[model samples]
Target: MRQYLILLLLFTLVQSAVTDSPRRPNSNPPKGFVTTKGSKFVLDGKPFYFVGTNSYWVPLLTTKEDVESTFKQMKNAGVKVLRTWGFNAINGSELAAARNSDLTYYQVWNSTEWVLNDGPQGLQRLDNVIAMAGKYNIKIILTFTNNWVGYGGSELYVNWIGGAGSTHDVFYTHPKIIASYQRYVKTIVNRYKTSPNIFAWELMNEARCLGDLPGGPSCIPGSGTLYHWYNQQANFVRSLDPYHLITTGGEGHFYWKKPVGFWYNGQFISDYNFNGQAGEDFDRDLTLENIDFGTYHIYPQYWYPQLDTPGSNFTLKAWGIDWIKLHAKAAKRVGKPVILEEFGVTGLENKTDIYPAWVDSALSTGHGIMPWQFGALGLTENGGNRVIKYADALINGASPNDGHAFYENQTTVWNVFTNAAKVQDAKSK
Candidate 1:
């Protein structure tokens, strides 16, 4: 009788442990989107598959009316997610224009420190975004910062804490900079901790240790350091809001071995050779327990500049397909869901063909994809990578002067988007 009682007690403890694991289903009623049973995402007790769009500029660029109209348009088109910017650190030069500049999102406190301005200038737009998201039944993945300087990213933080001309790695190591980031995370997480509209909190936007220029290559931090910083930041966010999911908005480019055979697994400082390959290791980063899912962004034209003709070595579409397959395989190895958070076509390429082919490959990954942006295809940025215009823009002849211009193949890509959403939704059902 005594032996049997001990056995029963052990069994109860084991079962409780299993149930208490973060990935395990909770006894409480399902509320928001969550990672369950490993790589699968569940919302309201059902599998959650999404067709999302990138509109990073929405919080800063669009007004309340424009935002409502935008979400209305997306809901009608069947888009389930909107990934937008959550942070906008003002550059020192941009402060003078903060009172009147349409782009400045924060007010400078002492020519160094910054704070969210009042009214429509700062995070009020984000508040409206969240409210609108709930109204439209759309989820939002809010990214903390950008890796580049275009929108006053890490440089802004580094400049404030470490002064200008500081290296990219300092943003991750500087004490003040890290604290500032933590403050931002805490502020936003606490603000929306109860809102079901938030799908996840992304650590940064395409975070790479790069040069001042948006796409220019620079010193890549050691893979271990990069992931460690990500882990720290992600864990901090989780501590603040344990209910929400977390992700690192890495570019998904793995760092390669330098000098032919270095056996570095990103554990020590030496693994990061400053003179060596500098980029994010998608597979390794996603392996962290703190990271709820994997994220990847591709610009085939930017990565593989050697675009081919009809039957050459490698076409842009083939490259895009290959990237998705490789990263999907990585995600499978890591047992995590991989999201193609951002991809776009160059203005010179025919998006009609590229978008469909990439979507098919993305769906094969058993997750989902979000193209570079939604809204309009405006003045090209970063070596021709442009947003895909809305279907209505193409059909209605919305020109650049009216805010955006439609590409010749924009309608075809939009069709791919709507059709893909329908098929994915059916599968989820």
Candidate 2:
């Protein structure tokens, strides 16, 4: 009788252990690393749906204290992921002539070779940003380069190899340029390959056939040039770091179909998004073996300025919702989770009125949403008096204000994000 009772107690405890734990049997990801299962993101064996935000200036900030404050404010608003620039290249000539010695840069191109800046005001700044994000329990998506010229993008590479007259698209196919990019990528990937705080390595920001400059004769859109480049770089990063996720960081343009039209306000416009002129095929790119998920951005005002006017046949709100639905449908077909990675409106009222509906659609469709940018309040000295202003407004001592930033001071817009984050958290369970 005594032996029977002891065996029965042991069996009950085993059952309870199996039932109470959230982890699935035979499923384990590296501690704190996020992995995907089917159409959902899995972290520690459970589905992980989240609300995140972007702040490209975080790594370029001058101090660790500022970085910590940025992460803390984001955590307070329920941001689980952050996206920032990982590459900042400058020509050695430009560096030598620059008036600001305090500026941060990751790579420099000399006459014969490329030099990586890993000291203070360089990669070390990125190191601090990552460390603070880890301390605050947030993950980061580091974008390797930009399609635009804001922070030394593909154009810079072309300049390094072909001088002033070279075309922008060669950055994708030029053998020497590709090798230089690979060298930089390998260095960054190996440095933090073991860190669990990295959510993904973004290949580039808004990659298109045309960048700050015109494309060459060979830079044909819908020609699979960008697609091939993405595949090569993604495979290279994976070889260096198998733990982190990868994404194209394109604006989610599609080339499979051509010239789809949509009503904007009162007039009909050909949807350039569906046209292959951007050298992006949303569906095709997501199908890449190493590409983990899909990402799309919504900025109706920028994409269709006509829609911003009153009395339109279709409203921006309606168009944005449809955009979300379309991408969600695509994710289902591809069998991977997709994120509405960056989106925003110009007005606070527009955001307050439209964001909730979009968030609801994202939640119902099992998609994650991250606003274009997150803003925080910070203090600075002005003539011996302390002044409070948006931290982003102080970047490089000037605001890049694309008019999409939202902050804690903006209670209504801020609530929409915070509440949606809570709802996403609840649904993840």
Candidate 3:
């Protein structure tokens, strides 16, 4: 009888352990400006959809007057949602040109102290942004950090913890750095927890555990580590901010294999290496319970094969459409909304139809879409390629007006985007 009791006790222990493990929880509040009902965004108890843009560099890179002008342009274009960076904390010399010491939302005063200032230079700028967004009735998706080195994100954390020249994974594992990150997170969340202008709190701009060094991109650690980091940070953020939604802010590059029904040409998957891009795991990360929504970016020129190749414009367009459907289906399966948060192409040629195509897909099946960037200013940082370069420009209060302006003579594209917004507004009403 004692032996039988021991066996039963073992079984009970096993069952209890399994039951105690956390599962992905759904993050749908009943009534709010940014709640979710299943896979649809519910604003004021009505289904909400948006056509948005990334004025990510505005908080620090542009002057207060420039911020007003740019947001005015966005409002005129009917951009309902504006995504911006909430965190830019990088110091030291290697990539100093893009380091804005004054504008960093969170600063490391010394090795052990992080000065999370809300004064003129720190969180006040974001405060001003939130106020500006409210003026135009625009909701904001504020991202915390970048995964890459340009803006002193994961690399900065790694260096601060004495892991200089190490991979970004260290930032997740290092006790001291993680503590510092938590402090920063608590500070920001507590500061803006009551603000209604924020639509969501993006955990990171693009959270990846890329083992990139100072020079270039290198290998990645085990893919599972990235997912674990996302889960931890996301849950932490949700715990702090009860009012706002949360998302991982991944580039929508899938780490999972193509689904059985999804059609893909060799060039589509091979030219850009989607699976390993930024070392992301979309299938796992997006479906997490605390993650209120899923986001992906579509940058064909940077990721797809050349137009002259066999992939061709038609194939490219088809792939883009399929990518949207695939992720939308994934979100639906998990009962969450998805957004094509970033999409763009460059050149003198007109690509007005590109935004419309993606926007249509998003509205009909998904939640919404945001163009790569919008605002009066051109890509002023890092020669207009990466947003991380905004840090350097902010520190020196310099605006490098590169030629990558999304608002320059963009009448056709703007009309398509705003037209969609008008439809969404009608539905909400």
Candidate 4:
């Protein structure tokens, strides 16, 4: 759904005991991390790039040892930021507090959710996580909900109970929904308004525009739902927190008309416009008045040449640099900061790794990127979409370096970021 920040700052006191050198992001965030209009942010004063990963879900209500490892890994890899989700279990405290009318994302088998209520713990919990993240010098592109709350898939609906009654997607028509969202935002912005580590406010991860559910056309707002959620979420975030950057972590918003929110109906450029080969890739003009940054989620599902069997040959794997370039260029052309939020060559057998040089080329533009994921804990016969073993190797219990994709020369993505940051720094002067 979105990328996660796999980083942890567990070695702070120990490091301080040995040496007083500060960390990259935490040591005192550079002025560049701040958001200012006209000259909002400059990588070394010039356009900068943000490279990071995503944690599919965060169990704010409960703690997990593995979660910390992911963030630690990203930081070790020099990943600057993390695209993370604000958890809200379909059946969590927030929804229980909502009691009945609200929707919480408790449908999935083994997914964690983080939602808030009218109490101090929820708000305090977020602040605590944010503070911990600050220790690693990691900024977060935080999303309010998950992808299980909408449609029949994984989305973060506030009151979703995931029953027959709650199967249908919840709409903004509910006042409680809007109020809950606002309350969460107010809590976050009011508390961290001055914090430099918070990167941006991602409205929702992969708000879809579906003509119908994967099965049929009975989905509410199926075709028309995309625009509804996009506009509403934009207005909602702006009304609550307008200071930082705002974006929807959709699959590919460069040309895809709608972003995450509805999960209604949509098609990749080629499939929808041109018969699966190539299409009229015009900018959808999605830069809503409230949005400051441009964002997209690219997982090779649509772009991969042999999508179904991309894993058949890692060499042929699709989540490569060329795809990032095309998508970034499209976003840049649209006049907004480009972000590759959800993407990774995450497959069981076909794990096609993105090499570093390819990363160097893609990040040459110095744009921000959040690699699709941080860890995939356990795969229950997944459709080869996620690789649990890789995530397992990427996770750990004590040490913090577990969540990073370690094979740099092999994977090459880690190098992509370092190389880009170097170039961006050189240009800053």
Best by TM-score: 2
- The segments of candidate 2 whose C-alpha lies over 4 angstroms from its true place after superposition are 1-28, 96-101, 262-269, 379-400
Model 2: lDDT of residue 167: 80
Q: Which residue pairs clash within candidate 3?
A: 25-289, 98-392, 99-392, 100-395
Return the lDDT, model 2, position 386: 22
Alpha-carbon lDDT, every model: 0.68, 0.80, 0.67, 0.47
RMSD of each: 10.1, 12.8, 7.0, 13.9
- Consecutive 10-residue window with the lowest summed lDDT within model 2: 381-390
Q: Give me the overall lDDT of model 4.
A: 0.47
Per-prediction TM-score, please?
A: 0.79, 0.87, 0.79, 0.61
Residue clash pairs of candidate 1: none
On residues 150-174, what C-alpha lDDT tens digit does candidate 1 reach at each position? 5567777776777756777677777
Which model scores highest in lDDT? 2
Task: Output the better candidate (2/3) by TM-score.
Answer: 2
Query: Model 3 compared with the native: what TM-score?
Result: 0.79
Where model 3 places Cα greater than 4 Å from the true spot, the runs are 1-32, 92-105, 108-113, 211-223, 257-278, 305-315, 348-350, 377-404
lDDT of 3: 0.67
How displaced is residue 145 in candidate 4, in Å? Answer: 0.9
- For 110-222, candidate 2 gives per-residue lDDT tens digits of 85358989988789989999889999999998899999987677777888786778888889998788878888888888888789899888999998888888887775655
